[model samples]
Target: MRPTGVQPIPLASALGRIGLAGSGIRADLPLVSGITLDSRSVQHGDVYAALQGGTRHGADFAAAAVRSGAVAILTDEAGAELYAQAPAAAGSDVPVVVVPDPRRAVGPLAGVIFGTTDRDGAAPALFGVTGTNGKTTTTYFLDALLEALGRSTGLIGTIEIRAGREAIPSALTTPESPQVHSLLALMHERGIDAASMEVSSHALEFGRVDGVRFEVAGFTNLTQDHLDLHGTMEDYFAAKATLFTPERCRRAVVLVDDPWGRRLAAAAEVPVLRLRTEPADEGDDVADWTVADVEPSGLGHSFALVGVSGERLVLRCGLPGGFNVSNAALATIMVLASGVRLDELQHALDRHDPFTTEVPGRMQLVGEEPASIVDFAHNPDALERTLASVRRPGGRVISVFGATGQRDESKRAVMGAVGARLSDILIVTDDDPHDEDDAVIRRAVRQGAEAAVQEEELACEVLEIFPRGAAIDRAVARATPADTVIVAGRGHEVWQEVRGVDVPLDDRVELRAALTRYGFSVLSAPRIES
Candidate 1:
């Protein structure tokens, strides 16, 4: 559903001096009620922005967008020239506006056409969470906690965008400027007083979150991933730092367990709430909020949240792992620092229990007998953490994972090495090999794993299997009742991309099927049959 809070601006009025030729063009130019770049999502009264892409030009799909009821077209000079030369439909003349840089104009034009001025008039409180990992989980926790505190909250992240019972599947980790404002407006109309969103580094760098005004910004420790896009670790970190600028957020909640987080806290202009799991060594003096005596059990964690004011708030988070305890403590401090009543703190944290249960694909366990975990741990840091989390006292750790095609090939070997050192048995498989040869990708990861074992002399067996379903089946069949099988990469994703085509595949489903085939009771499986 489109957000109604922003008044739709007339196409003619919004486009000041942009010339329109024929009367047909004027009549065709309906009010720009919405803006979208994708032809598939174009609706009546929407403007389609056509930009040149790497593989295909958006101008090629202009006809499709018009047919799908896009009222006007915004394109670069090349796209406008092409659209002008192309044949017009029988009774339609699509008005095309030729901007110098369609991408740059698309965002601001969306802001103007959508009437999203940043005038502060009691707008909903916005929270942004960013880092290499745990953004989705932390956002979910904040959303649930806020809602439980009698505040209607909207959530936008990797999994979904939810306001009340209405949910929209997310296309981007953070939506473009127009969609961001539009979603916020929808939440406002739904009586949502607050919103929590996952702000990705790419989204921040690309101006996808330009117009967002956040009250609280959060940091979940940074680690290696997305080096292919950013070109360097420094570049990746710079993008994340943009969210903590004074213009974007008023306060920051930083988890200083990682070196990057500590550095960011030191650099932030906004007041920071620092959370730590380990004992303070040399840096405890600078922390504003510190978590101490962290104890992680099967169900949750117990820790002490000590404020800089010397006030102690004991927090028992119903989220597994010590990492999650830091996440919860950071989130709790962020909300409390945002002016939440001290009396409401415990109740809000109590509500975090239910929130932790719904984090999709985050260490999600499946199967009854052998038991498997599906996590989005594609990088070395996350892989090591996942292995450490599920390490049973006397059980073996079987890991199934693969590197993505055409992205940070440098990390492939590192991931392999970490997997080899952590898991007793490692099964290398396919993970969104998008247009690249799957074997080549698997071999790169295998090389890393082999290097790790040879260099460190770790006693681990690494095996490569093609056709991801077969790999999952083999791993599940081989796992004993006491062993834990972790299926990493492509967590919660239903489609597997190969040669640009997305095929239907889900790891959890295949694992359950494999366990059932092996005579295991399916009653205790974590995933429900679809």
Candidate 2:
């Protein structure tokens, strides 16, 4: 639904544009400044949209919205009935416009209400990244590259929203439909010249990006995630595929790292530029962008970003893991594909890595002298890669991680096995055990870790600890001066989800406290800032 705002255009004019004017909408209905889905956030001259929610219809809150000064409402037939039936709304004069599906129209309607169209002047080139993982990191990379090119960048992702100089903590990987449009409009208002956003499968399938047109659409890689929401991997891929269509975006930069991506690149309707991370993916002529001459550095990996034109832009990657290298390369190619001048980016790089800027919680080194690292690697692929990347030169790898509750349970065992196989020590802990038995979750992970130790005939020690904080402490306390402690999952997040409530928890904070508890000195310079 819409959010609170000033009603600028006449409600009739907007409804007429969408051919909804005669459908119980008064021609002289109040002009709305903005739109909001939240009834609690309704303001004067606002159009509140009552949508079908998972638990309850938003129409149930229409009276409350009206009380908060909502002048009009857009809802489905069922919500309209409820609004009419409510005693408080029985005689309420607020005009209600009924539609078959409010979610699909919220973005478009919001665009009209907030003037997200060209009448306000051109909006910055919109770029977006979609994938199971790396969406946030890719957006960070894209925004940094854009800024280096002298563009006032706007970034919207899982961690935070950056509009010009303002940064706000994000509530969703992709915000609600109206919020997406409204935020873009606000970015335009703030004189942003370019924007990058992370598009989740849920956002694509749920109409969150309905009316938004991306200039450059990027795909990092697709993996098994949100199976409960999409029901199958094919369904998940299809939802992501929607973002690459000519209708949604004009140009596409797809990473052909996995089969899903290869398929997407082949099927995408727009002008496509495919990026490959494999140095041995033979037939270099088939790839548009390729990774070559990759080398492991002391802090991270460095690779040559080779474009189709046969020119290589080599840079050191400050972020860890091959996946990160792929993300960095994809970000560079995406920027260039967005029609950015290669010389500008090359000049911006000078000799530094695009990742010279800090990427919070993505291999964030919180302490040294028995190095402690915190990252947001929650899935099997991400966890495995992070552990492999942080393997000590002649030391051991200590991994502390857990599976998220109420998510793709199918991936839990795989994640456990990966951590167990890759790390010298695996400490299984809780990672957002929301509404699920924490013990059951822990047991499932330990079972997989133990199974991996048996099947692979590997010699990795595994431990299970209740509560995440104690797990962090135990992992760090057991490590020696030469060992590395890597805590995966929940990066840049200040809270942990437990039993439907958010408890204040930061992985970096916990890791640092654990290091202090182990008497580890801070005199050893932190390799990477959290």
Candidate 3:
């Protein structure tokens, strides 16, 4: 939903500012109060963006949008033609602003309509973190860090959007450009000084974050995923690199652990502070910030952030896994690059334990007896890291996971291979098989596990289970006190899509109930609101 306190702008002035004007209408006729791409979400005085889609043109629903109170139409040449032929346009005089590319124009239109683009010290300092795995966790950590520094913060990510303490559940990692701007405006209205946002490659490629420039953009790492949308690794990396451009952000804090991060550090258009969260090779260039002296602390680890000039800040993460260290280090460096003094950050770190903030679904703990956990490790790299981190000294790792249907089919087998290599028992199950056959999806995953087991002669037990709830039950029931049960792929996701229907499924709830039924002691309910 859009904010309520927006100042309406005349349609002619808004169009002229963006260099686009409507046809067959008076300049002073319509006043623009808000902008939205969805015809169903149209409000009075809103500009309905009717762009062409893959299969159907959005203009097909212009009648609905107009009825819902859209005063103007924004579309491409093709959409304009279709809207003109629509029955709703038979005698209608609604202005149609046709552009060469309407998707790109939506961001600027929303920006002008929402007053977010030309902020006069009102917009929150936007911190954008982009990567395959750590975006959510890093953004959460950033929000906590900013709050510890006595700044009011907001968050926009896969889990939800927050303005002060109010939260709205999110459907995308980074929402459409209009919502992105509107949320920032809402945060400004609430006196939030800063906001941490998860910027996915899809958001960059689809123009979801076009009109916003970040104070500091962070890169976690690049890995194979979303090949269904982007066909190659280079294309995926290219989409992420767009966030580091001068038009998108002022400065960048890039993690140079993987080759992709190193490449981004060398190629970012904005000034960059290179951070190394992992060990560096002898020939690698010296990083601006490095993580050192990492030691196990409770469920997580404590580490030192050593700057190139010998400045250091020690911090601890309450989250499990070594990868969390990378996530925390990225958040710390991003805050430091934003001008927070080292001593101040260290004080905040010590006083508030900001790095130990609980991220809802990233390595979320549900039980301690069998060490049951849930994570959003749908990709190959994330699955490998998660599996390795959950393995105990004498405990067997029993993993239950599945690949998402119709998305990056190439990662399915690789994820399966990784799971088999790391987990002692891998159970292939169903994730969101949106419109694809569930059995077919499970077969691909199972085949990969079988192939890996046979080729490597690994002593791993591979099983196939259907209906994700039953899979979680089986994994937990089979586990002993010494085993670690991990349910991955669909963490924090509360529904599963089969064909066109959304079935209710929450991994944490299911895991918690199963653990209780198995007589295992589960952790208290997660305190962080989703």
Candidate 4:
């Protein structure tokens, strides 16, 4: 989505700004108005970034991009060769700007081409949140808090991208660099004062956020997830740490509850404000802000942010669980790091109650009688926290979840064990097989649950059900009025991929219908269907 009213720059000038002017073997250059990575989305006067994929070269579609009115082709040496051989390059005068690493170059190119570069203060003040979990909720909290402070804000995260009231569904947690700059430019055009974004490890590693400086970067806790991409936890942590550099962000607010957060605070290249949501030892270095005097409110917690300098601010969140407290704390501290005064923020909180904003599919409530919930807690740590949080003193916790195919297979067993240990009834089901055999994925998860029940002599009942809709129905059918039925894994996702095909499956809709069918009263929020 390119912003309107930006003056176009010469293709040669855009390449020169990114240090690729003389290093290119190219043809006639034209004025470049926009940039895109996908050939299908190319517009008139756009530079088509032909990158190499895992199995296919993007240059294979060079002809299509040219036909769609691409003024230039941005590619690497290999991509240049492929484009030269492409049929569209035989007599085409389109310029081919070659770079050593096109992935990293796309950011600078897009920034320069779209007039969103650092030469002018054009982009909004960006707040970035990164971690294994809590990223989505924290971004939502950031947006809400910014709005409460009287700033028109934009949001870019797992669920959607927003510019004021308009929203478009998100395809990635962090989009490709071209689209990122384009969105930032669009937000600036629409007069959005601030923005909050979720920066994933994949985004950092793949240079998706290159050349975009955040006003204040935030660090949530790191856990064991996405090992398939990083290959190790250390690598994953390093990737997230890159976002805190002085070149990337002006300042940082880190949650020091875990060793990872503490390490990040000590290692960040920018000024840091250490925040702790849980208790710390007496000898430990005092955090810049600590969450204190926590008490349960309606479906949430009211807490005070006590600063090291005798500053105390009261804040409350409508989201449940101890983790949400951490999330809310992180959002508040990041806003303060961006220079919001205590009294100003308190006034907003008192009037708007922004932290209590509902983050869809994080810990979403669907019903009341049986206490139905739908969440995206696929990883082991998230599963454990969610299962423990949803438990009632006298009622049972019934969970229906499964592992996603081709993503950190080692966590499947761990998640299964966590579910079995914490839940009274664990029902294993399919979660987006994505070209892998569904039965094989289910077997591994079920085996882990069965093993936990046998080794620990747990009183939990384990069941394996396929075709998740039936599993959801079975979970509701077996639950009593006191039991809490949690449908975990695919939260807010409307499609379930099986053998490369997307099938319609929204957990909220499924849970709502099942709860209504079983005589349980569901929430009257019409946004659930939307």
Best of the two (1, 2) by TM-score: 2
Query: Which scores higher on lDDT, 1 or 3?
Result: 3
Q: Where in model 3 is the C-alpha error above 4 Å?
A: 21-26, 525-530
lDDT of 2 by residue, 70-131 (tens): 99988999998999999997667889888777888787787787766442354678889999
Residue 269, candidate 2: C-alpha displacement in angstroms = 0.9
Error of 4 at 521 (Å): 0.8
Q: What tens digits encode model 4's per-residue C-alpha lDDT throughout 385-451?
A: 8998888768999999999998889998888899999989999999999988999999999999999
The Cα error of candidate 1 at residue 338, in Å, is 2.1
Candidate order by lDDT, highest to lowest? 4, 3, 2, 1
Q: Work out candidate 3's RMSD over C-alphas.
A: 1.7
TM-score between model 3 and native: 0.97
Tell me the tens digit of each residue's lDDT in model 1 across 1-530: 56765566677655552233333335335677888888888888889988887787798888899999998888887887777666764356667876666676666566556555452543468889999878877887788778778888888888888876788778788987768766766776677788889999988877777756689999998898998889888999988998998878888888888789988998998888777766667745567777877776455777788777887777776644556776677778778878997768876665545346557677766753565777878788888887877776678999999999988888899899999998999999999999899999999999999998998999999999979999988898788888888899877787889997989888778877887888765534445322
- TM-score result, candidate 2: 0.95
Residues 209-311 of candidate 3 have per-residue lDDT tens digits of: 9889999999999888888888999999999999999889999999999989999999999999999989998899999999999999988999999999999
Q: Which runs of model 4 end up more than 4 angstroms from their true locations? A: 25-28, 281-283, 525-530
RMSD of each: 3.7, 2.7, 1.7, 1.4
Q: Per-prediction TM-score, please?
A: 0.90, 0.95, 0.97, 0.98
- List the candidate numbers ranked by TM-score, top first: 4, 3, 2, 1
Pairs that collide in candidate 4 are none
Supply the TM-score for candidate 1. Answer: 0.90
The count of backbone overlaps in candidate 4 is 0
